[model samples]
Target chain A: MSLASLAPLVDAAAVGDPQEGVPLALYLAVSGGLFLLGLLGVLTRRNPLLLFLAVELLLNSANLALVGFSRYWNVTDGHVFALVVMVVAAAEVVIGLGLVVAVFRQRLALDVDQMSSMKG
Target chain B: MGERIVFTIAAASALSFGTLVVTLKEPFRATVALIGTLLSVAVLFLLLAAPFVAAIQVIVYAGAIVVLFLFVIAYLGERPIVEIGDRLGRYQAFAWLAVIGLAIQGFVVLATTQLPGVRDDPKQVGDIGSPEAIGRSFIDDYIVAFEATSLALLVAAVGAVMLAKRAVKSEGGR
Candidate 1:
């Protein structure tokens, strides 16, 4: 009934023999490193388009971690979640770029800091 | 042997190009670096035995998304807004230090945690990430969520079109 009770069944499919597949820590390191790069980019970059790219990097890093854990646990959930995230990303980009195009059509300032027109 | 080598190359390339994507000032070059990062990550997916995800990653991410970025960049023709000589500020230094600290904490966690089966059974995860399994999940337990995603996508499509469209009538008919 509960998730803890399902541990045995879940572990049956998990990365049974760790000697064969890649090390889990290595994957985690790479994913975390990429995520940091993305965070740094988002923090430091001013260009909105560059910011979008950094966001993509962040999403990809999350995906990598999901897949790694999926393989480690031998489950389908992570794959499905990552796939759904990918689709969400596609939809996000469409709207984001559309908004950018519409706004830039009026006044083409590409800086993220310059878009704060909703002042109180 | 082969597996470790491939993983190293893939990880190295993924990080390298990812760094380039964040750091590069040129829009065109940054986009290309992002493509490289996507491709490398896809390869890593393949190595992780998610062949279906790897293929989709290539097809959807590298093939479609990056190309869409390229098209938008080309059409906009607006130069990257990052200026020379004054790019890095105190804010950037603070960000760098904060991220490095976060990275160190994360690395510590990764080093200490124990996996369920480490060097024990030595069995491979077979076909879990295959299309069949994923499709079953989409239709079975995740059916509602999957259908909701489709509806959201439809709305997003229409919304994107509406947002990008100019009001010619309001502007006295262009």
Candidate 2:
């Protein structure tokens, strides 16, 4: 389906009255799909950059689920936790990128498969 | 309303760009996609009623972190050389399936279980959105964590400088 249609459905699930709108089941399904896509990227991709992107996707999926639950319950803690997760994600990207640069300088390649050769 | 529309757009952008970050063969394209994803995620944060976080997401993530990624991508050269296979091995596939299954199960449980409902008290609403309120709360409730985050940033700066200096030395020697 088109993403435009999916938006209303997701919004309805997130903010609609408990009885109507998109069902929680559907929201969870979408989250599951995203998580699976990320997992496939991580498992199949050999590039460290792509692997990190997959990791970010994994985190974003979790954030989506968190926001969905928060909206359903009408609380702010999930939102706060999502904020914390974002901060941690930013920090992770910095450190991960640094490591990537260092590794690339040493090995002149960005492949995760080649990183296995750690004979210094 | 506008909020919902903005949230939808942001979420879609984040997802599509995130996918591109992984699927693009060129590391430069991946870095660009990553930056787009981060910007969209910051917008998502704004939709969630956390403006402070949204600002931080833009400033720290899109601004600083992504620049770091781009620098690395540039330094490593922008050659599109990485080859990707279509499918993972059996064990990896199984592991991915298991993770997805577990996440779905957890979501189902949370959706079905009768946990304490979300508290929408006026008091809770009053303290969450404003920058001043967030700052006050951080200082009051999470002082140590906040301080630690600052320390971490300091360390990162130092480490980055060290690495740059080493690179300069090695290049000069060559």
Question: Could you tell me which residue pairs clash in candidate 2?
Answer: none
Q: What share of the true interface contacts does each candidate keep?
A: 0.52, 0.16
Off by over 4 Å in 1: A1-20, B78-88, B118-122, B167-174
Per-model clash counts, in order, read 4, 0
Model 2 chain B: ten consecutive residues of lowest lDDT: B117-126
Residue pairs with backbone atoms closer than 3 Å in model 1 (clashes): A16-B122, A17-B121, A17-B122, A17-B123
Per-residue alpha-carbon lDDT of candidate 1 for residues B58-117, written as tens digits (9 for 90 to 100): 999998888888888887785444343433465678998989899878856654455655
Question: Pick by TM-score: which candidate is best?
Answer: 1
Candidate 2 ranges with C-alpha deviation above 4 Å: A1-37, A60-87, A117-120, B1-4, B78-92, B116-124, B165-174
What is the DockQ (computed on Cα atoms) for candidate 2? 0.23
Model 1 accuracy (lDDT, Cα): 0.79
What TM-score do all the candidates reach, one by one? 0.86, 0.71
